[model samples]
Target: MKIDKGISLTKVELDRIEANFLAAWTGDNSTPFIVDAPISASLRTRGTAIVRQTNLYTLFQLCPTLATWAVLTPLAIDYGASNKNVYSHISVFTNKNFDDAQAREKLKERFRFAARRIGLPVVGNQPTELFFAPLGPARSQLPDMARAFVGAALHLGPPAVEDTPSARDWQRRAVATRCPNLTRLNATISFDRSAYCARRFEAWRRGNEPLTEAEALLFAAYDQAVIGFGRHRSDLVAPPRLFWNGFTLALEAEPSQSAQSIKLGPFPTQLPGGSQVAIRTPWPEKITWTAGSIAQDIEVAPASDEILVFDADSGVLLTRTALETKVIAVASERQVVIASEQFGVTSFGPSIQSADPGRFIAWTITGDELNFPGRLPPWDHITSRDGALDQCRLDRPRRNAYSFGVGWRVDPQNRSRCRRPNQNSPRTIR
Candidate 1:
């Protein structure tokens, strides 16, 4: 009964069986395998292709992070530059690629994001003309494509577009938001001088005669865009106003300076003590003012530093030292409590005759010398209703005072001289 041993299945036969079984279970050409993954392998392959084949402009549209690498790669390979001191390439790429008016105007939205990331300086007045020559023939007309492009840009902040249109749009939005800090894109692009000069003269009744060529150019461009309406006479020609109608202009003059009559367009309710006005100086650009030559005083400096304090006469820089630097206000039966950095705190009562400084009142103080490891300073101390000087005192002088603990470092040269808060007052948590 030794029948011929059954022939073993050949490799081809085995493969055929496996294939047939798979087909029967899942259908031969059934929906192509689509295994879900975090990142699609197909997309990765496409992105690799884009990196190799895409142009510089298109590359930006696809991947903005490439901007860093693109500039780096060239300088690294050709100029032997390193990331530490390779600002030249960064500047060039940013200026040349991002600042092109025509390029930006086309991809305005994308350009806006790029400008923000790179921090472009602000130019006033003239609209940014991104394209020198039209992408198509109709340069003067606002094409549907351009409008759609702007709409799309507004929708997709950074991930979508990569041109000047985006940048200008962003700037407009920022200005509308009343954000004081603004940087311009394409700073090298000059402004329209005629429009700028006209607008400046209208506003201040003075010409920018002393402006340098560069400054003049920038101002000119800003005026043209903001005021000229890009050679059109439409309703959008005027620059956005920064003031509110019927707003009161208040003034509290310092005693040292003479009482001078102030003039603005239309006068609202007169500021009782004195109307507040801004005196802008030309050199170093300072602003200082006084109430009726003998009233309360406040002065802002050339460096834009401001000091608000009570003054019989704005004659000298007042300095008052206190036990705790954070004292704010003093309270008395008849007089109101007042606080100033220089005067500490004072209670002004009708009966009390002499003008004198008083005891420490409640206020907030920041501990500059507090060595807190892995922690930020108590900046939000102002939120505390009861004014308390936020001081950082140590429990054990040797333990937390000198060193904030295991993960702290004081300069080796000045380690001995470093002063730590003594155990007199404990670190106030509030």
Candidate 2:
């Protein structure tokens, strides 16, 4: 009854059973017990000796289910370190009734399945030289024999689905919690970059470092605009193209010291399809003028505490802000302006007499403040100069705003204008 050790069957008994079965089923002298019958008497004697010693015959006698099967023990020579060889002792059991062509096809199919399960490249019909390279440890190898046994068991009794968290579920939760603000700006962000940001945030939380004004602003933007409220809404509006345009302009501009002469404009004159041409002076006295003719003479003058933008053709002023800040401008069909102070990057739009004032978007570099407008701000709010002054409101107060940890800490030597708060101490914006 112990099947693992196998049963003993004499050659005479095996031959007799085969003869009886052949006689009863088909009137022939063929025997299914032997594979490739001997041609000469001497060869026949040698094959008979080999057959008696084989575990295949014993396996059949021990397990009645294997009676109609042929055993193929595939020996794989695995190479180890230092040119040493390690032999893999493996076996494959298949039906004996299968023809040469059927057996070959079956072997290949099994090999392909095993290769795929182990993340290996499969070859057609037979294994190629490329397949022989040792990919990993032999213990992790999925051979055809294991696949066959496991497949047969699973087919008979399939496993139930367990109530456990899957990879997809984890990914969904991560995307929802990490960068919800990005959902509105999804087209502008790459998945790799978002994942990287998530990792950075996690690292910052663990280390407890102070965040720079730019870092704090970007983090708050992702938190307020994306994760906190953006993803839940079905009708999310796209940020304005001008907002991004202005933001890009500010990002490219060289960082200047306080009260330094930073250039603001030499922006293109014409509107997208309009005839108006524009020109502007550099910082200290930031002024812009747009006219129909490029040859029109206009005197450029610097103003100490004001940033001015105007359309000379219509003699209409677009925007005027008197904040003590550094200014940078981008000119096109529409005017874009960026102003950076100790707090963060703030954007504003131009005021056209008949049109609504431009939108505002600001990212406060200081952690203590959160400015969420009743409406979603324009995308280009970070770079635009229009409506910049009206949008500079400290609506909400956040404690420990800049405490992301060591990775985001602003060096004290560079903290000339901005105060460096204690990393562990909570701070509030007025």
Candidate 3:
């Protein structure tokens, strides 16, 4: 036999090299050295695995490869802007199987299962449905899962559902159930529909069926929540206005007309419990609000920390804060009089009596003095008919001041006070 030394290899040496290669391939490095060669090779292996998978089972068998692709594709592929590549791959896989529906259903079931584990909902059951459907233990329990999914989409946002026939059917059912008339009256301002709704309210008002105070308010407010009517133009619902009863009670306990004008410095701050907050508005009807989910109505008191007045159109988010609850008392139709002792700043501990009203009219009490006070009358003096004391007014002839204190003996009348605090005075009279 002609023996070629070059071709002759001992089993021991062959085995030794094979062992080292296998160790490296299996991610066991003999030394602490890192090699780019192995990483590139590993990526090639993953890419090939994704391309070669014939079915969901095989695809799952290559889960490590699939997961690797899932992470790298968003970076390596222009997948976010366009999902054509992934969709094409799925289509090809589905086509290879004789029954497309079965293949798709299997894939969806698996993929949705995975999505739910990661907090994302599955898109849909149909190929055309391009939106994601949220996963839930009882998502399918709803009368129409797809419609519930669509309604959830509208409410929460991010139309992750596919625009498939089944998804559309689901959306139709959901819309019919939740807000049957909302779609028909998308942006209507006419009171036609409101007038219809009012009939139900009129029934409730006429005692045909008793309603809770909140339910009644919601009924009336819903009728008024139109774009061109009732103080606002949007139909967004706001949370009920909130007033801490404990805080209001504290202010009520103080002497009458004991409107404490504490000024909170030049910033917003959370007041302690029992601080008075007085909100005001001209809507004539009281607004109901909920704090942290407990429903309550705004009240005319002084102990609440911060009063929020909601405009009827927009929901609670559009509520404006007021410095005081005092308004021009509607005692006579011919004229209106203002009241002194406005609510003070919420951010700091000073009243307008001690601090400048600042440039922010929103932050200042309504009756407080400012550079160009809106609708402000002038401030003047009025001699007490008893000839004992004098009162101040926002315009002239103090009509009302300290009805609970020294000025109480002067006039039972209430009017805005324009008395500038004496710069050198710092007396706290009991």
User: Per-candidate TM vs. native?
Assistant: 0.22, 0.15, 0.21
Output the worst ten-in-a-row residue range by lDDT, candidate 2: 156-165
Q: How far is each candidate from the true structure, as Cα RMSD in Å?
A: 24.5, 30.1, 28.0
**Clashes per candidate, residues 3 or more apart or on different chains:** 47, 30, 41
- True lDDT of residue 99, candidate 1: 47
Candidate 1 RMSD to the correct structure: 24.5
Q: Model 1 off-target regions past 4 Å? A: 1-215, 229-430
**Residue lDDT tens for model 3, 37-58:** 1334555453344334333343
Off by over 4 Å in 2: 1-3, 6-77, 80-106, 114-123, 126-134, 137-430
Residue-wise lDDT of candidate 1 within 325-378, one digit each (tens)? Answer: 222121111112122222222122112211222211121122222211222224
By TM-score, is 1 or 2 better? 1
**What TM-score would candidate 1 get against the native?**
0.22
Tens-digit lDDT track for model 2 on 30-133?
Answer: 11111211123443343333333454434344322112212211222222212321112222222123335664455446544443332223344432222232
lDDT of each: 0.25, 0.26, 0.28
Q: Given candidate 3, what's the lDDT at residue 356?
A: 18
